[model samples]
Target: MDNHTTIAAYNLAKSAYANYGVDTDKVLETLDNISISLHCWQADDVGDFETKSSSMGGGIQVTGNYPGKANTIEEMRADLEKVLSLLPGKHKLNLHTIYGEFNGEAVDRDQIEVKHFQGWIDWAKKNNVGIDFNASCFSHPYAEDGFTLSSKNPEIRSFWIEHVKRCREISNEIGKQLGTPCIHNTWIPDGSKDTCVDRLGHRTLLKEALDEIFEVEYDTNYMKDAVESKLFGIGSESMVVGSYDFYLGYAIKNNKLICLDNGHFHPTEQVGDKISSVIQYVDEVLLHMTRGVRWDSDHVVTVNDESLLIAQEVIRSGALDRTHVGLDFFDASINRIGAYVTGCRASRKAFLFALLEPTELIKAHEDKGENFERMFLLEQLKTLPWGAVWDFYCLQQQTALDNEVIALVNDYEQAELLERGEVLV
Candidate 1:
C-alpha cells in the first residue's frame, strides 16, 4: 500500500485510438492512486477487429468465441509479470471462463493446459514466482454446448464432477498458499426458457449433481443411508450459483457459497435487490465484470456500456455485509494486458464513485420506505431514453482515452492474443 491513493485499477491498450487517453504503463502507475486490487477485461479482451459496432457503440457481434488474450498459464504468467512491473504491491489478478470458448472454441483441448493445474503449480513454485489465485469454469469438448454437469446425461455429469472437483481442489490449494481463494464464478450457459421445461431441467440437474458431489460425510458414522451412500463426498454446491432460487436455496441450506456473476443478471434481474438476496445467503460473492449485447449476454466491459446498476448492488452488499471481488473478462481476439488493465481500471472507478456517494441517498429513500436506488433510476428513466444519455457518456469517455500510446490498441475493440501469441488466436 505504498500509494494508497494510487490503488485504483488499470488496463493494457496496446496504443490504439480507442485507448488514446490511457498509457498502458501509466495506467499501471495510476492503480497506486486508486488502490485497486486487480484489473479485468472479461468480454472483449481476447479478440481483434477493425471497427466499432453501431449496435452498442462499442464492439461488434461476431461468431462464437470468448475474449481475453490468454490461452495457457505460461502466457498468462508472462503478461502478469510484465503488468506487475508497471505497478507494485499487494495486488490481485483474475481471468474468467465467461463466454469461454465463445462458440465451443475452448472445448477442453489439451493445448488450453499443456500440463494440468498441478503442473502449473509446480512450475510456479519451482521458479519461485509469486503466485496469484485464479477464477475459472469448464469449457471442455463435452461442453460442446455446456459443461457436463450442466447436462442431463448421468455419464457426462459423472465425468464433469470429477474434473470440476479435482480442479477445484488444486485451485484451492494454490489459492490457500497465495492467501486468496480460487473463486468460482458459475453461470450456466444453459440458456433461458427455450420452451419452458427445457431450461427448467437445468435446476434439478444442478441440485442433484451438487448434493451428490457434497453428500459424503467425512466421518463414517455421519454417512447418509448407512451402507448405500458414498463415504468421502463434499457437496460441489459450494462452487455453483443455483439455476433457480430453489436450487440456490439448496446450496445455502447446505452451507455452500452462492457465487454471483454480474453479467448473468443482465436483461433479467435488478442489480441491487438481486445482489442483496445473494448477500443474504452467501458470505463470499464473486463480481463477474463483463459486458453484453441487448439480448445476448456478451462479456465485454466497454466503459460506455452497462448501466452501473450491478456495481451499485455490489457496493451496497459490501457496505451492509461482506463480499469478494472477482474481476471477470475474456479476450476473443484482443490483447490480454489491455483486457485486464482497462477493464479493471474502469470498474474500480465505478466502484469508487459509488463509494463516494452519500449513505443518506439510499437511507433517505429507505427512510421514506422507497427503494432509493431504484427510485433514483426510475426518476431518470421517466425522461431519458438512455440512448441520448449513453451517446453523451460515450463522447465524455472519448476524452478519457490517451493518445501517446492510444494509436496502438486494436482499432475494433476486438480481443487479444498476446498471451497466446505462441499458440493460436
Candidate 2:
C-alpha cells in the first residue's frame, strides 16, 4: 500500500473500531444513539482475589469461577469470538490476556498446557489487533519483593530473572504465533510506599530487574522481537510513567517504551507529570479502565477526570502513530459487555475531548511559563456552549444530540473541545 492507502487502512480500521462494542442491531441503534465510539469487550482481570458473590472485576479472583456459565476454556474462548463477530470488523480488540485460575489456585504462568492462548491467537492472528497484558506479578508468590524486587540473595533474584525469561519466551511464542505484538501490562500487586515507589533502593532494584528481563530472551529462540513494557507497576507514589522525567530520558536512551494505564493515572495524585512521563519512552497507552470507587483494588471508573487533560497531552505529543490504545477492563459479573462498553465509551470521550481541546492551551503552555498541568477539561468545558462543541466535533455528522446522550453528558466532545481543538481523527 502507498502512503495514502496505509493511512486509509488505518482510518478504515479506525472507523470500524470507533463505533466498536455496539452490536449490529445495537450499532444502528448506536448511530441512532451517539455513544457508538465507546465500544469494547471485557477480556481479563489479574487480581487473585475471588469471592462467593460475583461482581464486576471481582469474581474472576476465584478459581473455577465461571459460575456454571462459560467456564470451560473452549467455551470461554468461543464467548470471546462470539463477541468479536458481533462487533464486525469496525472495532479493534483490547484483549486482556488471561493468567487466571479456574477456581482459586493460581495458574502457573510457565504452563502453556491449555489452548486458551492458542485459540485467541488463532482468532485474532491476522486482524487489526489490539491486546493488553493483565497478568499479576503476584501469581508467582515468590515475587513478594516485585518482579526484581531487590533480592539480596542471588538465588532469589535469579529465580525472578528466570521467571521473567520464561514469561518473555511465552510472550514471544504467543506474539509470533498470532502475528501480533505482546503488550507488557505490568501491575505490581506487591508494590507500595517504601515498597516499589521512589526509594532509590527499590528503583535501583527495579531497574536491575528490568535490565535483566530485557537482556533475557522473550522466547527460547529470539525469533519474535517483543516490543513492550508495563504501563505502571511501580510504586504508586511514583506510578505515573509521565512523572518520572529524569528516569524516562534514560528509558528513551535505552530504547524502552512506556505504556500508559488509565487506572494508574487516577486520583490525579498518581499521575504526576502525565504526558511528559512517557514522551521520551512512550510507544503506546495501555487503557486500564475500572469503576473509580476504590475497592482497595483497581475498580471500574464510574466517572471521568483529568484523564481528559492527559489525553490531550497524548494528542499534542504527536505520538498517536506510536500509540495503540488498549483497554484493560474486567467485569467478573454483569454480562461482561457492561465492563466493555463502560470502558470503551469513557476512554473514547476522554480522548475525543482532548483531541477537540483548543491548541491554545498547548501553545499557551509553550509560550508563557504556564504549566500544562493547569489545563483541565472540566474547566475548559465551562467556556464552550454544549451544542456547538458536541454536534460538529464529537458526534457523527448530522447526528442529533439525543442520539448519543453520553456525548451530551460528556460535554468535552463539542463545545470547549472543537473551538480550540486539534484532534485530527
Cα lDDT computed for each candidate against the true fold:
0.41, 0.42
User: How well is each residue in 95-206 modelled by candidate 1, as lDDT tens digits?
Assistant: 3322122233433421223123444445445533322232222333454434345577777777665544443444455555544344433333333222244545765676
TM-score of each: 0.57, 0.57
Q: What is the lDDT of residue 408 in candidate 2?
A: 38
In candidate 1 the C-alpha lDDT for residue 91 amounts to 48
Q: What 10-residue stretch in candidate 2 is worst by lDDT?
A: 30-39
Model 1: CA > 4 A from native: 1-73, 84-90, 95-115, 118-139, 145-147, 186-202, 216-247, 266-268, 296-299, 302-307, 317-321, 331-336, 361-425
Candidate 1 lDDT score at position 267:
53
- Please state the error at residue 20 of candidate 2 in Å: 27
Could you give candidate 2's per-residue lDDT for residues 1-425 as a string of tens digits? Answer: 23343344434433442342212223233222221111123333332222222232311232222221343344444445444333312344433334322354444543422243454455455544433333324444455444333455566656655555555555566666644566544333333424334455555665676576777545422222212323344343333222334245535655544544445433444441455566555444433444333422344434355445555566667655555455444555433433444454455555555544446544666577666544653355444432233233223333223244444323522332233323111
Q: In model 2, what is the error at residue 286, expressed in angstroms? A: 4.4
Query: Which portions of model 2 miss their true places by more than 4 Å?
Result: 1-70, 82-107, 110-116, 126-135, 144-149, 191-203, 216-250, 270-273, 280-291, 294-296, 301-303, 331-335, 358-425
